[model samples]
Target: MNIKLSVVDQSPVHGSHAKIEAPRLTVELAQLCDSLGYHRFWVAEHHDSVHFANPCPEIMVASIASVTERIRVGSGGVMLSHYSPLKVAECFKMMATLHPDRIDLGVGRAPGGTGLTSHALAFPHEPHHGDLYAHQAQMLEGFVNGTLPADSPYSTIKVLPDSSPKPQLWMLGSSGGSAGLAGHLGYNLALARFIDPDNCNPAIFDSYAEAWKKAGHTGEPNRMLAIACICAETEEEAKLRAGTAVYRKLAAQMGQREDFLTPEQVQDRYKAMSTSEQAFYDHILKGYTVGTPDQCWQEIESLAYQFYCDEVSTVTVTHSHHDRMDSYRLLAKHL
Candidate 1:
């Protein structure tokens, strides 16, 4: 299929590890992936969440890029609704100044937190009255490229460290809602298939391609899909490790905040679940690619082909750090 593999780490607080160790693990993973030849290593942003430790992906991106030489580092993404687009552009620009072409500025419209936390993030400023995500995105690109309309109030303000290459801009969305906007504005589209597997299909890429063509873009659309995946030497081992992911999804659905459970702990919890709850867990598992290395690669390749995209970014979580690390190592052997 001639596809590239990437990573989107959520800095999960797993098993007995302290919350602080998650970010360190992200760096460790990035280093390993860099050496193993992963294309991009992106961190995630989450606020007020027990499962994920990274609230600010920009800082993590800089840290990861400093240690890794080749892989692209970026947010999976920055929630643009919470901050000014100019500030976001400046943050990425500063990183690009340090890391050059190795940086990516992937932005999303989601709040990245609970409603109360989302509200607090916008404190001191009046709640925005409308859907300004598109506007923010446009302004962000304008600021990044020094291309804001001449009449705009901020047109005269130039982003500093401007001589350095700019970070690649990406619109991150689970559904196809932002595909046209991303294409029309010349940003790459990274569909979070792991977040919304049901709606994630070739049509999203088609939408982006159509919009790109309509906007007079001259070449093929630049896009990728991210999937939740787990790998092990055997099917049983992979499914066992995936229990942690299934339990994490259950906990999130129930509004619970707990460290990621070990596979053993998840097994116990699964036995205790009612039949319906068990069904829910099984349903979540269906969204993930979990199996042996060959099994995972086959599905990932098929998905990339189906989506007409050349890159597939993986999001993997396991309670045992060794198992998690080994999963990527095994997957890399296929490459």
Candidate 2:
């Protein structure tokens, strides 16, 4: 099966470095992906955390677009629950105006940070629980296309510097329920396969495809499958590096949410894990791919075909920034 490749750079702020250097590492990595012929280069938004530096994805998107020539730059995604739909539309509208056809707006239901952070972001708006993302998504779509309902309060609001085209919108989720919502709304879906480690269920893809057609999508289905990847020269090295996530999962099980670990952190945590905690590694590593480039590509290919995903976006994290770049470079060479 032929599958396009993209990236989700989370700007993990780890290693023996200062926090400010994280953004620079992210920019350099994105530039490398752009030059390496990757289809898209997406950034993530994880606020109030020492692990990730990018809190506002729109800014990162702009920064990426400025330096790249061909690749699409986008959020992987922006948590719509924390902001106004009109504001999001306007932000991406300005982005589209600048980079026309080179921008993506991937929206998510998950709040990027903790509950307190989400509360702070949504303070004036007063967070509502049910159907918030669906509402925001619809409004965003309408504004992006100048189709806002006349009776709606935001009808009079206009996106400044609107242009001929707008950013392509995508819905990101880890569950079939969210997939169905994206389909019903006629938006593209980006499944967060990286997060849900236990679901090898192929029915999720079947349901998403069915939902796309059921939602009256006449054109071809546009979607992406995202997963974790770790590539090294040797399978042993890959497996060793892949244990970072395993240890991080164990840490999370122990109530620490900031679980993106560096190599040192992983080693320390792994040594301290109890037998039961160590047992969780098998389950945690299920969704991840780690090996030589050829081995890694085979696994990635299987995942893309299983989901019938048009594009595969990988989020690669490792102890060394150079190793992370090498992982991507090697995967590109083979994939």
Candidate 3:
């Protein structure tokens, strides 16, 4: 197993930290990840959430790429439905131009939000036409390969000043549909184990690999899994910290403002949960690797070996930025 590691700085804006400071922290973390031999650093896109500050992934990737030397930088996903395929290709191509070999384009099928927020970000035209993701993916491939039609209006136009050496494309998914699609298309797959906890069985990865073979793709498909990771010096300390982080995530999932509570507050909240609620919390947290350094390494190794994942992306969400940074440090050392 290669045991490559990546970071998805989701830009979770804590209640205490100034919203403006989130980007800086993210950049700093990216640089640190690069220096520590991380394979990639991805930023996620979100809007209308006090918890997350990143609304534009391309700009953020560019900024982080400018400061890092070796690490690949890209979006955890571009949330494809929100923009034109051509525009998405152009933006990432521009990023590839600047960073050259250090750029990736991970696309997601979902709109990434719901209700008025989704409406606010909706594309001008029907975003999801028949097989929209597949069509867009094909179009994007054409743009990257410079093989689109030459004379016809839409097909003929090419992304200008394209500096990309053909950006690596990956499909981001929380379910099997994305896995099958990515495999069929011969693109990389980024599985979010932390998102769809109920559906995160190792069999999903087996299905992906089998589908890749069935798709007749000559090369092995690149498979990645993102997991919540919290590592500390002691098992108790790690679990405590991870529990606190999980509490914050649950609060956010329940549409509450995240990061407003202190560690003590998190503990109190966790204590107030009923048995079923605690079971749910424990299940979600099970998707995470949290313990002492040895235990964390064991769990991560088990996950990678079992899933046959090419890389593991760790999203460290601790109350303290220092603790988050420390967790990454420990992970890098072990990974």
Best by TM-score: 1
Per-residue lDDT tens digits for candidate 2, residues 1-335, read 67899999899765646778888888898899888899999999987986678999999999989988999999999988888888898889899889989999999888777788876887776666435778888888888878788998878776875445789889888866677778777788888888885663567767777888897878866788888888899998887777766666556667777635666667677678788766677667766888999998888888877777768899887766777888899998964
Best by lDDT: 1
| Comparison by lDDT, 1 against 3, better one | 1
Provide C-alpha RMSD values for all models, in order. Answer: 1.4, 1.9, 2.4
Cα lDDT tens digits, model 3, 216-294, are 9797777888888888988888887787668866776776764546667767887899998788778778878898888
What does candidate 1's lDDT look like per residue over 118-178, in tens digits? 7788897754522799999999999998889999999999789454579999999898999
How do these models rank on lDDT, best leading? 1, 2, 3
Model 3: lDDT of residue 140: 75
Provide TM-scores for the models.
0.96, 0.94, 0.91
lDDT of 3: 0.78
Output the worst ten-in-a-row residue range by lDDT, candidate 1. Answer: 122-131
Question: Where does candidate 1 clash, by residue pair?
Answer: none
**Which 10 successive residues of model 3 have the least lDDT summed?**
122-131
Count clashing pairs, candidate 1.
Answer: 0
Better of 1 and 2 by TM-score: 1
Q: For residue 179, give model 3's deviation from the true position in Å.
A: 1.4
Order of the predicted models by TM-score, top scorer first: 1, 2, 3
